[model samples]
Target: MANYYIVGLSTIIGLTILSLLYDSFDMDMYNCGSTLRNLVVTAPHDTTREFSSKNVTFDIAGKQWKDVIVLVHIQKTGGSNFGRHLKANLMLEKPCVCQRGSKVCNCSRLGSEKEQWLFSEHSVGWACGLHADWTEMINCVPSMLDKFENARQKRRYFYVTMLREPFARFLSEWQHVKRGATWFSSLHMCDGHVPTKKELPLCYKDASWAGVSLDEFLSCPFNLATNRQTRMLADLTKVGCYSSLSDAETKVKMLESAKENLRRFAFFGLTENQVDTQLLFEDTFKLKFMEDFIQRNDTNAASIKQEDLTVEQIQRIYDVNAEDFLLYDYARDLFKERVSAMRARRKRRIPS
Candidate 1:
């Protein structure tokens, strides 16, 4: 009787130890999986090759509700129109509530009015600074959200943006500047410090670069508008911010970094490809827009005739925006590939 009792006690103890070990192993695997996912999603990759869509997966609706969508609004990328669409056009279970004469809308989560799901100028009002770049957004957005919520919680951030053809975007920016539009309020925060006057001088002495000629616009070596898209999308810190702006090697690194970072973004749209942009956005987030996106060719930049410029002047424009031209080409190709993959996936989902 005593031997039988001892055997039973030993068996129970052995089973309890095995269960605890199994639970610990399971938890470890879960933590490991989370870490791996983060690494795959966020880590910088080779800029030479295109990334496969198979590895890029997201919990669309769940993330849209639970996580934050950060928009890196590059100027003259048709981002303003897209922002408006996000605020008013999206068909959602909990639509963003906007107030009259307000620049911002309440893009709160499903149940929480205070906790926001979308972080952009339209939703959060330049919370990271006026037209914050990728470097500034990545650094400021997470902490800003924590401050807004008055709590610290780990939340995934999905960054999105829109890209435009380099020449058109540059022309649009010039037109905007010509109309007295100045992004002078932009902090240009990088590496925990704004670029000093010596590091980044103003293109004009006046309050705004109004009525500036295209030649004058191109003449300013410090003109942020020259390669605006590349600079905005790149991690400036990698190229030593504005300090190494003139270095050829630095420009190369910045362009490469920008390409890699753009690839890492959750989604990006092309201003020229409105239909594809809308379809991709809808498929990406599992959310629909109330109306189809309309392609507007009659933009400020479109008004500028290429035939009006000399061959030399055209070459100069392309030379100045060389980095942006490369970046845009890369982005457009990637965007098309993703759109094709999305269409293929949709076809597969339909019943035979």
Candidate 2:
């Protein structure tokens, strides 16, 4: 009896010591696992853990390869270049087939040429109308893909986009308009209906607002160029499409809606932070770009020197794009936080 009691006591102590060691060693590992799970399960919601720790070395059957990537191309946000990159730059097992001097590319999924993995202008050719906004794309993409494939199958969609500094983007759009560019083909579909002329008045009576002065451009109250990013990102129904609302109310609701939608996106990049954008994208999707993204400081918008503008002119620009400015500020901060977290995770994984 005495020997048995001693043996039992020794067993209990050993078990307790093992539990303590495990608790000490596994606490960090457990936290990391949780973070990774949250990242995958509830991404864009949890900003703290933005990358997975698991080895994401490419697999043809992996989610990254199987699922679709939808690009919401906001105008003048370097989206055209990024879209081109998506079609031709990724190190994929089966590269997109591009024809010389053609804007379209065949980005079919691996093992099935009939099915596509990318839905963008370069691949799908504005299937959801020209430069479809979030509301239209979300509602239209799934059905459009089904129609394109001529069959229905469940597939995950990871929406991505690029955002630029508000004032820069605004100026870029103004420059583009000045150069005779027009998106008159753009179907501003919202809530299953297009805005009527009464709701969305044209800024110009001519075919295009070409050679328009800055004063004329800003004078148009219904100019889509104003707060273009925010409107493109937000669900238009929230503010009754293009229906009239008090200026104060419109600003508040639109800005909040835009921010919320931005947070929900699978991934977004800033035009200014090309390097970090590439890194964040690679980390998020486990895909690599063949070449580094080059930053261009000599864009049309960048050419308009800040010193060249008057104080009131600058103030008007800000006032017109107030919502976009707020949205960009939020996006910039969130982007930084996500990049920092990814870097820290990568650094920890390296051998010391």
Candidate 3:
């Protein structure tokens, strides 16, 4: 009778264990996302007023800020992709809460709202600006430093631009806005997605395509290689391009100095080749972007019109951008080294 009682008890325990295993194994899939989303509601922060999908400037400010930065956009060197990446990944991580501010991206009313929703975010502490006009940027530099310095705390990192080799970047620009066939939102200026003289950006329309013939225009972009030094000095004068450069080397040196300072600031992305305009950011930004990223911006290969230009015309186009390539080549290596140093510094600060 005792043996029978022991066997019954063991059988009951085995059945109970089997029932729990069957119930838990039925479906492994789960909606963990809903649970996570609920956490945001309880965190005491509001996402509605704080984040604007339409606010491009906020796209710059809301990201993981590093004291002060200026995204010196070079026409088609993946600036949009970088901008998108900044907003979704970095800014979402570190949002702005300070209400009283004067920077372009930083607004008074929005900052207050952001502060209320600050509980909603874990923003990295710092403010940076994006820029286009070199002269305006230079003038603002001292003040930018002042703004960061006046605060008791400041971020150690800062930077400005990421330019590709001129030739490659120029092609990327050409490919980028081919109008209707691809996903360039700014392409709205064109009809059927083709860049007419009217729809082109001012930089491209005014200088690059002005005097060139269609055959020449399609074969290669002209005048894209106006040296950085020449442009910087030329922009500062009351008359842009009217300001005479006293010495080319002096201008070059000044740019070099500025770049060195902003070396910490500027994160340059390059086009790998002049003709194809492939990306150089994988190694530089230390992040590998997916194809949909490239497909959205440059899709020229999809519906390309073949032009059998002579080797000479191709060389001329190449020559026009040779200076940019050289500059990019030199800068890329230095920038990589600088980036490595930054990573090293960060690793040292990490607690063992």
Candidate 4:
């Protein structure tokens, strides 16, 4: 009887694994274009209110939060400038092992599970504002964290993130990399051939796209080009690298997770709306972002105008990042909804 029971249990486990694998690969067959409408329902746009006061009270995520903000800094999205401004003016700066040690520390990737956990936890505990990747958020303060039973237990933990249109971000990142931007050296390194068993994130491994022309870059692989924003938003444990997203089940799971995370964020902004983002963030947090701050304005040098890219290149970028475009569309809609709600509240407060 015991032998039969064990066999039954094993069979059930095997079936479950098989089901998951099947779901992961099944995504390849579906047409994303047909499903995009279902994915991103358009929201009514709202006019933003101009802020004049510093002491205004605001509520976000259906709750009032005055302190604590976690900024998920997506790469090449003007997140650095935002994070720096936040720390220099409003919030306590967090210590990144990479920042403290070198321009790029392989500690997170090279270290053991325990080491990574310690780094992540310490970074979170030490900062009034965290500007790390989404992976750190998942590792240190998972729902399973012993110190907190739920997100409410850490009521101060407010999440925020900024996103760019995928194609624009990709182009900017590519140009930046081509210029051999020192900060992006590690990421650039991974554009080459990736070993299947490498411990680093898959983005840090694939070399097929490195040192290639625009056409060649597209042909080599689409790992980094595809759904990076979504991957960053999803829990890292489930979404390791872009390669993992190729599995239909994993892709679905990751997309669902990203959507859920987006819902949880108190403030989601777009790079295209930098001024509005700054104002909204300040008004929401009751903290000022740099308006008079002198930043290195290398806009013309860094930017590759959309018109410069040929139709074929543009299409390739769009085709590779279909999932990201979908997520981005959803994020834009969500941002509009949140902004509209805020605008409505402010309008109601004003007396005629």
Q: Would you estimate the TM-scores of all the predictions?
A: 0.84, 0.83, 0.44, 0.58
Q: How many backbone clashes does candidate 1 have?
A: 0
For 41-118, candidate 4 gives per-residue lDDT tens digits of: 221111111122223233322133212355677767777666555544433122224356433321211222112112
TM-score winner between 2 and 3, please give it: 2
lDDT against the true structure, per candidate, is: 0.77, 0.76, 0.35, 0.49
Q: Could you tell me which 10 consecutive residues in candidate 4 have the lowest summed lDDT?
A: 41-50
Better of 2 and 4 by lDDT: 2
RMSD score of candidate 1 (Å): 18.2
- lDDT top scorer: 1
Tens digit of per-residue lDDT, candidate 2, span 143-240:
88889888875665667899998888988999999999989988999889988988888899999999998888888899988889988998778888
- Alpha-carbon deviation at 339 in model 2, angstroms: 0.3
- Ordered from best to worst lDDT, the candidate numbers read 1, 2, 4, 3
* Model 2 stretches with alpha carbons more than 4 Å out: 1-66
Which parts of model 1 have CA positions greater than 4 angstroms off? Answer: 1-65
Model 3, TM vs. native: 0.44
Quick one: best TM-score, which candidate? 1
Ranking by TM-score: 1, 2, 4, 3
Number of clashing pairs, model 4?
Answer: 10
